[model samples]
Target: MTEQDVREVLNGRRAQAARNDGAILDAARTVFLAEPDAPIGAVARAAGVGISALYRRYPSKEALLATLCLDGLRQFVTIAESAREVPDPWEAFVEFLRGIVDADVHSLTVHLAGRFTPTPEHRDLAVRAGALAAEILHRAQQAGVVRNDVEITDLPMIYEQLAAIRLGDATRLRELRRRYLDVHLAGLRTAATSYGAMTGSAPTRAEAGARWNRTT
Candidate 1:
């Protein structure tokens, strides 16, 4: 074959490969978000790609999930950073909490992956996001808006509960979820405090993973 013809063919193949990679990632995100433990074959089917093609791009389900988890973490960091810029610390904290739950609802698989088996990159991103969340939480606490006993780790548990709201019927479900979330947020306010100290230890990653695995 002529050199020019060979070059054209190579470029065509590269474009096809890139398209396949994008399709695989998009499919994985959708399939896994609905069911975090979905099998690799399900993702391949969703991508409309052969199993071999999917395997070529991601050696294992874990590898694909890790990538998704990392992306989700980065998105979360962006949201938290943006919320931090809000003029009112209390508003920023409330918005940050809501944003995390929204993210988890859209990317359930990433949420589960981070808690269960995070890659090194995912872990690093989680740490960064956690630090940002801590800062937002601290600001609210210092403002005497959030309860003094609230811990940073308690944030994930709140998201977890929020995520439990069924989304099968989108419109009605969202309204119900919003109501529940509003009630929960109101409870988090410092004025909601009654008398005694808040009980229980802050949630750990290991415990979070165990709880997630139990549900899935």
Candidate 2:
């Protein structure tokens, strides 16, 4: 083959690999979220890729879980950073909450938390996401957009609650999440007099971190 033809072939192969990788990751999230113990073969079938191809990329289920958790953290950080840039505090807070609901990172945490060991990189990303989220929450509170009773630590639980809505098909689930989120958002904006003050304490950072298996 001519050098140009060989280069074209290599480029095509790379593009196909990228496409396969995206499919595998997306399928992994859907399958694992539904059934955390589902076999890796299920992910392959869901992605419409061969089992060998999935294994070639992920090596093991643990590897796939780690990648999903890490990617979720990256998504959280990206959303928070973008939301923080919005000119309006309330709008920024709403954007951040909506993004979290869509990303559904907490659902991954609910299902996959004790299944794999986290590396130092994972810890760093978690800390960074936490810090960015805290900044966003603080901004909203300072502007009186969010209730003072809300705490930074409350966010994990909020996301977890939203993630628990697993009924219905994809479109239906999306609609339900948004519907419930709007209700929750209104509550966050002001305390209901009948509800009184937010009782009990938010989950401590330690309590949240305790769920994950950080050690190898």
Candidate 3:
């Protein structure tokens, strides 16, 4: 009933409002990505809020949609880390390569994937991913399991082709890409004269490089 109590009540309301708005943003993304034309009620249901409450904050469904797409890319980057678990460096590289292929053709680089520019934070994450691949490739090469001529930075382009070919023909694409990777890896494993034979003994810990444990 007092002035101080009234102020506290208003402040609490404002805080709750902000939290509701944030929840709407998150829920909007999930709803639309799950089904772009999903009803407003669906968004409310997904958000654990009411339909009226959703509209009260975002007047237009379009506004809510735009927010969803804008936020989707960050989530994509977060999901891309699932490919980093393979232990062998060459296989680890393949895991990342295949992941990019799926991402480009199916999600992150696809139409509804949203235009998430590479921010410094995102770019740094990308750098870490690439560095991890390179380290793995280096180790694989040292183990005589991969080609020595391969460059660590060439991974991105390899993935692009893999995705494109896969989209065009899934079976042939996998065969060709796998063959190319095997041959490329073979070359990197040994000298041109030796034809990159797998002459090394059991893989040494040092030759495996740092184990990839991508933070999701």
Q: Which has the higher TM-score value, candidate number 1 or candidate number 3?
A: 1
Write down the worst ten-residue block by lDDT for model 2.
Answer: 190-199
Ranking by lDDT: 2, 1, 3
lDDT of 2: 0.90
Runs with alpha carbons beyond 4 Å of true place in candidate 1: 1-19, 105-117, 169-173, 204-216
Candidate 2 lDDT tens digits, 8-100: 999999999999999999999989988988999999999999999888899999999999999999999999999999999999999999999
Candidate order, TM-score descending = 2, 1, 3
Taken over the whole model, the C-alpha lDDT of each candidate is 0.78, 0.90, 0.56
Top-TM-score structure, candidate number: 2
* TM-scores, one per candidate: 0.79, 0.92, 0.41
Q: Write the per-residue lDDT of candidate 1 for residues 118-195, one digit (tens) a residue.
A: 557766877898899999999999999989888887877777687777666767766776778798888889988875
Misplaced by over 4 Å in model 2 are 191-195, 214-216
Q: How high a TM-score does candidate 1 get?
A: 0.79
Give the per-residue Cα lDDT of candidate 2 at 100.
Answer: 92
Candidate 2, residue 175: how far the Cα is off, in Å = 1.9
